[model samples]
Target: MTTKLLIGLDGQSSGDRALSFAENLAKLIGTAELLVVYVIEWSPYSFQTPEENAERHKRREEEISTAMERVVTPALARLEAAGIKAQGMVRHGNVADSLDSIAAKQNASQIIVGRSTETGLSKRIFGSSTANLVMGANVPVTVVN
Candidate 1:
């Protein structure tokens, strides 16, 4: 069976670093497949009127479409160009939960993401989803710096 790596992207430099790391890892594993996912932070716990609900739904669709177009598409193309086996997905939900869910459903051997290195913002103090995933994911988790 081929191994799989579930890579979480946040559309930032950290995510880019994670992708680079995954590319190398895919190389090392040889038969590994990279499953790249970008989770758009979304909250459904808001009160809304009929019109508001319609607008929110439309916005959500736009976000998903944009992410697939702007993020997933390019990443898949690059991986494919490098002769790496890969696929990608975009979802709207809590980042950590969504990534873990995808990993479980895809049977990924490991989950990889980039650690936040923003100056002055401690992930421990702010509670990044990367930290949450490390704490809660069922599979092994890797954080690329």
Candidate 2:
């Protein structure tokens, strides 16, 4: 059976490092398929005007397309160029939950993400995606610095 690895990317330098780490690990594992996932966060509980609610679905699709073009597509191209069998996806949800869902759905053996560089108030308030994944992931998680 082919092994699969799910990677979470946020279009940052740390994300680039995570992709690099996952790529090297995939190479070492042989027969491993990489799935690069870029998540655009959305909160369903937010109050919205009727017009905004009416356009929410369209906005969600646009967001996914934008993420694919701006993030997933380039990452996919690089992975393909490196000769790694790979695929990509754009989803909207909480980061940790989305990654876990994708990993379970794809039967991924591992989940990899980058350590966030955010500090101070943001770090304390929002915590980090890496930490959430480490705490909640069903599979092993690798945090690339």
Best candidate (score: lDDT): 2
RMSD over all Cα atoms, model 1:
2.2
State TM-scores per candidate: 0.90, 0.94
90-143 per-residue lDDT for model 1 (tens digits): 998888899999999999999999995444555557578888899999999999
Candidate 1 collision pairs: none
Candidate 2 stretches with Cα past 4 Å from truth are 120-122
Candidate 1 ranges with C-alpha deviation above 4 Å: 117-126
Candidate 2 C-alpha lDDT tens digits along 1-145: 9999999999889999999999999999999999999988787788899999899889888999989998899999999999999999998888889999999988999999989766788668878777888999999999998
Error of 2 at 7 (Å): 0.6
Q: After superposition, how far is residue 6 of candidate 1 from its true place, in Å?
A: 0.6
List lDDT for all candidates, in order.
0.89, 0.91
The TM-score obtained by model 1 is 0.90
